[model samples]
Target chain A: AQTVTQSQPEMSVQEAETVTLSCTYDTSESDYYLFWYKQPPSRQMILVIRQEAYKQQNATENRFSVNFQKAAKSFSLKISDSQLGDAAMYFCAYRANRDDKIIFGKGTRLHILP
Target chain B: DTAVSQTPKYLVTQMGNDKSIKCEQNLGHDTMYWYKQDSKKFLKIMFSYNNKELIINETVPNRFSPKSPDKAHLNLHINSLELGDSAVYFCASSHSPGLAPDTDTQYFGPGTRLTVL
Candidate 1:
């Protein structure tokens, strides 16, 4: 069984600054996928970014990027130039290449301070 | 158009009542899933269907039944809902059954917040 862990229960970042959310997972599979999903107060789940285990390079989408360290089983999300809209409950997820279920971690609520 | 949509964004019902939540995907994905987010914001998979066939059924209560009339729709019917069932349910779809890098990328719908009072 694969389990994702998000250590931070809540985080606060000043607007226009950067913040990083830590995530770690335990999985026996060598090849898998990692993802970060954000859920705002509207309750809409939006995919922020994703990374493939086979790729050593991390995944980046606009202001969101991931530090995917496969060896350490760490996949952290970095939000550059955080905006008020970025404040949300962010979840880190893991899925095996051949599996249909995605395991998610307890989300970290991000607060943007002006 | 919404890639994936769930009906009744907010469901408020009395305990012991039965209710159903509907989900549909317009992305033509072959696989659809149901997830429950508890009050603590922990998300867990409840059920999954691939092309109208039941694929993944987690350790959810039998009261929570999922029906799929077609590959594009998956509806959840809960019987005798309890206070513990008050959570946000999310519907998601993905083009899966393959090992493509993008195959398992799921598109989620605006969740349905179920409140059992």
Candidate 2:
């Protein structure tokens, strides 16, 4: 069984600043995928970024990037120049390379302060 | 056009009533999934279908049944819904399971909020 853990229940960052959300997962598979999904008040689950286990280089999309440390099983999301629209509940997910199921974490609610 | 869409974005019904939520994907993906998001914001997979074939079925109650008429549509029918069943249900799709980079990358729907009163 695999599990993803998001330590922070809630986070706050000022507009134009940066913030990082921590995520860790336990899995026995060597090759897998990690993802960060954001759900705003509108209740839409949007994919932010994704990282492949075999790739040493992290994944970056616009203002969102991930610090994927395979050895430590840590995948953290970094939001640069956070905007008010970035305020949402972010969830970390994990899926095996050959599996169809995706495991998700509890999620961390991000708040953007003016 | 929406990549993945769910009908009846909001469903409000009384307990013991039966309801169904429909999901369709236009991405032409071979695999589709159903997930439940609880009040605490915990998302969990409930069912999965590959090309209209049942594949992954979690430990969800039997009252919750999923039917895939085709590769592009998956509908969930719940019987005698309870208060605990009130949550946001999400429909997602992705390519078939494989080693491809986009194999397991899921595209989610807007989600249907079900309220049981």
Candidate 2 residue lDDT tens string, A1-114: 899999999999999999999999999999899999999999899999999899999999999999999999999999999999999999999999878999999999999999
Q: How badly does each model clash, as a count of residue pairs?
A: 0, 0
Candidate 2 residue lDDT tens string, B37-113? 99898999999999899899999999999999999999999999999999999999998966355887999999999
lDDT of 1 by residue, B30-99 (tens): 8999999998889999999998999999999999999999999999999999999999999999997574
- Candidate 2 at A33: error in angstroms? 0.1
Please list the residue runs of candidate 2 whose C-alpha ends up more than 4 Å from where it truly belongs after superposition. none
**Fnat per predicted structure, each in turn:** 0.89, 0.95
- What's each prediction's TM-score? 0.97, 0.98
RMSD to native for every prediction? 1.1, 1.0
> Which DockQ-derived CAPRI band holds candidate 1?
high
